[model samples]
Target chain A: MLSIKNISKIYKGSNKGISNLSLELHQGDICAFIGANGAGKTTTIKSIVGIHPFDKGEVTLFGTNLQANPAHFKSMIGYSPDTPALYPNMTGKAYLELIASLYEIDEGERNKNLAYLLKELTFETAVHELISSYSHGMKQRLVLISLLMHNPKLIILDEPFVGLDPNATRFLIDEMKSRASEGVIILYSTHVLEVAEKVCNKLVIFHKGEVVVNDTMEHILQKASLDEIFRDVTSDD
Target chain B: MTKLTLLFLFRLQNQLQLANLNSSNKDVRRHAFYTISGYIVAFLMFLGYVLFISIDLNIDNNIQAFFVLISSILFWAFGIWDILSGPDDLIKSKDRDFIFSLPLKTWQAKLLPLFSKYLIHIGLTFIVLMFGYLVTIAYIDHFFLAILFVLVLSLIIPLLSTNVTFLLAWVVRHVLSIIKWRNHVTESIITLGLFVAPLIYLIRSSASVDYKEWFIQASILRYPLNEINSFSFMQHIILLIGITAVTTSLVILLLTAFHHLVSSQNAVQSKKRRTNAIWHTHIPVTALLLKEFKLYFSSLTYVSNTILTPVAMIALNICILVGVIPNLHSFSYDVAGFTITAQHLFTFIMFTCVMLTTTTSCSLSFEGRRIWIMLTAPVSLIKIAASKMAVNILLFLPGIVLTAVVYAAIFQVRMLDLITIVALLFFSLLLISIVGFFINLHFPSYTWNNDMEVVKQSKATIITAIISMITIPAIIAVVYTGNLYLLLLIMGIEIAAIIVLLQKISCNNMMLN
Candidate 1:
């Protein structure tokens, strides 16, 4: 569903963001992209989502290059960053409507999706209030609603469970499985090994801006527990 | 006490340490340079005033008194302003959780941050006022006594102002919490009352020259400080002590009451939920414009500050219409011996009202961390920039058009000349908007803790103000010379510049700070 080919991004002078990083995802795949701190997981995700321009190589979403038509390409993919980057003055409903309009979603579909997400997240009472007054978990839920409102084919979330409560986290894991079962590809980066091990169908471990492990959950479990493998792979020499 | 001292030192370092901001960040460096340069310029201006006073010491006593009186009034104004917005800087910040989590008492948590923030403001007042006193006293016969008097006077005024302001804020907050209406409405009303009260006083006082004269005479600074006898000197000291002691007692009483009145439950709880139907525009740009309006009107600071210039313009026009202030016109002679009456001086002044609204300059920075929404969205960058510019122009256009019509009717301007002036105002507005947005695009500061920082103190805002200081005069000259073709040519150039800037902004993919 999504492809990143030979992408490279370097910082000002000394630091490296990503170097010749490549990744591919197929339909019905829930890939957990694991990495240590500063392992370039975010850099690669931002590059693929067209938030950061890569120095070399291309990102394609559903056979269309992001560089060729960034807007159209982005419409097919929903990305939620690690932090909730939202307009505090806007109400949750207004924000979701804005995302819908940006994707040119029809009013009927937009309303349906909005109602469903608000119901699913139990955010009906807070939808009318300004987002600045929302708690951290509420803001995260609103961002998730915005991501899912358009029903994008590819979902990319960065640390989605950071501020979520246990109930919300369970709902999110179940939702991801449901979305993947419908042939939607989901890629998320996380530090929680247990959650990833339980939920993700595929594991992609990253070390020093390069992929160290790319295999199915079954294959990885045969070698060692995901936690043991992640620690062993990412620990320093 | 130790924690208080540590917090004060930490805050001092946070404010004054240049190394805290990365030198490699272009926007940070530019903001630091511009802010420093602004201070330097203000210092130079103050030094010029000091030199002027030094040249003439005959009125030295009056000058010293005047400086002290002015300093007191200025400190009072700063105190009121701090009370309105300063609570958030100390009490309701991101660091509050971390600060309160440490081993500290409730009073320490409240008073330490308050004093640390207030120290910088009071310190500035002390330096400026004491410098004036030192310059005055260095030439006096009783230098030591003068120095002692100046020190006491400086300390007293700031202390009184601080305590009074805190008391006033506490009273207002308590009253607001007891009221029934939503928090924002009550706060907005109070904000408007505080802002309009001074203007109302100025207008009422401006009517009588005798009242103004009496005010000047009544100022303590007008007294002859050099001719003070022992009795009067003792009386002055007694009066100062009495005022300070009374104010301190009141503050202490109020502080105890305020601490009890204010609990976690008394925190500002905004329950205002917008229930109006959500309106969406057909065009994308219009949607963006609507979003801009939503952002602008939601904040009391933006509405209060943005409306000030237009209100002033309206008042000036009314004054001209009622013959309170005579409309200004000047005559210019061309090389061909043709006399031209430049009656559009008022138009220039009124058109310059757009300068008061720095919406375009701060719009991008106002986006803050959410700029990634624009960066990652399918929307074109030019569309984003144009929407911001369009909103600002649309905001100011109605006022400009209405005022232009009023000027045309009052001055009996010819059709062609009115069109020329209107066109001039339109082009100038567009030019300024584009320039302001372009500067913001290059030097955006997204990590601002307060919206006013971007609105008032951003490098883009100062740069835009400086540009207006030059361009307003230049445009007036172009109109003063009655050169229509030259105005047209400048308009063309401005249009071209805007187009080039928009192109550059859209095409470039620079690193996002």
Candidate 2:
């Protein structure tokens, strides 16, 4: 559902950001994007979501070139950043409602999705409180809820499981698997190999700014475990 | 002493790194330039005050006292604010956790971070007040003593103010807790008391009397500068030492008490939850505008500080219109003994109204890291910019209208002139808001940890100030020429230009590094 082709974002006076990075994900695919620190995982995600303008190459969402129709492209994708980059003073429900309105999600659908998600994520009571007062896990759950509120076809979550407690983490894993089963494209970056091995059917490994591996998890883990493979792949040249 | 020295050096190294970032990064450099321009404007204002005192008023004693008193009060007010918010930086900092995990003494670990964060505030105050002192002092030459007094007073002011603030807070909290009152009630009462005291006084006394005179008289009781020249050298030394000793000891005692009080009160009063019922509105711009207002109003510090100048301007205009203070010679320029007319005074007010409505200028920066949501949302950037502009206009409209109405009634302006005045001020506000929004788009700083940095200290605000310096004069010229057709032409062209600029900024690139 999403295609990133030869995209390179070079920070001025530095050789740090992504370089000639490319990725593709289709429906019913949970692509686990694994990388070490500064491996251009976030840069690539940001570039694809149109947050950081790439210096080179094109990104297409559901056959629509992002530059040609950015509005349509953005509407079809749900991006949940690593940090809960939300208005601190806003209530969780207000933020979700805002996201719903922006994505043109109808009131009935928004309410149904919100109720289910709040209960499932165990943040039903906390939704009325200010987001500023929420714990890290609560904020992560809220961000995830906002991401799912729009029912976007493609979901891009960066380090989505960082602050989730064990219960929430299990729920998130189950939800991703369920969404993937329902033919939604899930692209998530994480350092947690065990979760990725268990939940993600496809694995894409990034070293430096370039993708080193893009194949099924079974194929990548044929000889070694996910952790050993990740260590071997990201080790020094 | 050794730990403090090492910690101070580490703090200094971080400051140097920040300075380097400001110089090396283009975006940071631009922001630094704007912030420095703000400082330059403030310094020039101080210079103007000095010139007014030296040349216009030509009164030394009262004016000197006035300057000292205003500065000290301002210092104390900030000190109190810092103390109320200080514990957050002290007890709740992630850095504190990391430092505590290291090998450090109790006081060293606790006080070093607090000092590193707050001492800059005191030091900057010292430098600015020293400049004010140098300009105001006309007595016998004691440069060394003057410097010493400024330094000593700067230290004493924060120490004394923080001590008093916490003692009062502790007392209020204890008293309220005993009486079955919530902690927020105490906070609200304290905040209300602090804000309303000056407001009530200003309303009652400022309209009828020269506000400077009131400040000059009050200075005698509040500031030590008023009494510095009266004492002999030995007496001055003794007084300084005595004040320092008392303030320092009080601070030490208060710090211990503050720690205990905080430890005892683990259950902070959480505000009642707000209802988050979704009101599905068809208009996206309205949603964005409401969001802007929500964010703006939720920050008490942002609203109070940004609104203070505009509120004071309105009050001054009222004082003038009512013939209470007779006339406004304070802001008027005496060029070749020709006192400018009230029209020029109205121009000054318009200029101030445009300048003080900073809601639009820093709104983008205020988005901080959350800007990603806007960038990735299906909503157009024009809608975002328009929402910000609308909020700015709505915020300044009531005050501008009230002030303009009073001026019109007092000046006996005809309907045509009143309409002209209102139209002109509204157009100026639109133009300034656009200019500020554009500058922010170019030099946005989203890395700020504090809202104050984005709202007040960003490069966008300074750039807006510089643009105002140009726009205000052009506006004055338009009014000074008094051609109705030309005024219409200018306003029309400005609206068109604003539309085009908004379109260009949105279409090209909305985010800056």
State the C-alpha lDDT per candidate: 0.70, 0.70
Fraction of native contacts (fnat) of each candidate: 0.38, 0.51
Clashes of each: 0, 0
Candidate topping TM-score: 1
- Candidate 2: CAPRI quality band: medium
Q: Which stretches of candidate 1 lie over 4 Å from their true place?
A: A13-16, B17-73, B76-87, B90-94, B138-141, B157-224, B227-269, B272-283, B298-307, B319-345, B509-513
Question: Of the candidates shown, which would achieve the greatest DockQ relative to the real structure?
Answer: 2
lDDT of 2 by residue, B293-403 (tens): 877665544564455545555666677677775544445556587566765766666666665566677888888888988988888777888888887778677767776
Candidate 2 local lDDT, residue B330:
49
For model 1, residues A3-23, the per-residue Cα lDDT tens digits are: 888999876534668888777
lDDT measured at residue B134 in model 1 versus the true structure, 0 to 100: 62
DockQ of each: 0.50, 0.56
Candidate 1 lDDT by residue in tens digits, B1-513: 686687778766555434444577555665666676676786677666655654443343344344434543445456655544433344354466766787888666655655665576667666766666666665455666666666666666666666655555555556776674424334544544554355356545664533323333333333345634367665876786687678766655544345444433233454645564452424556566667677766554444445556556656666666666543454343536645443554665766786545778888888877877777666766777888888777767666766676667678777887787777677778878888888888878787766666776778888888888877777776777667798787778778987888788888553362
Q: CA shift at B273, candidate 2, in angstroms?
A: 2.1
Q: Model 2 chain B — which ten-residue stretch has the worst lDDT?
A: B217-226
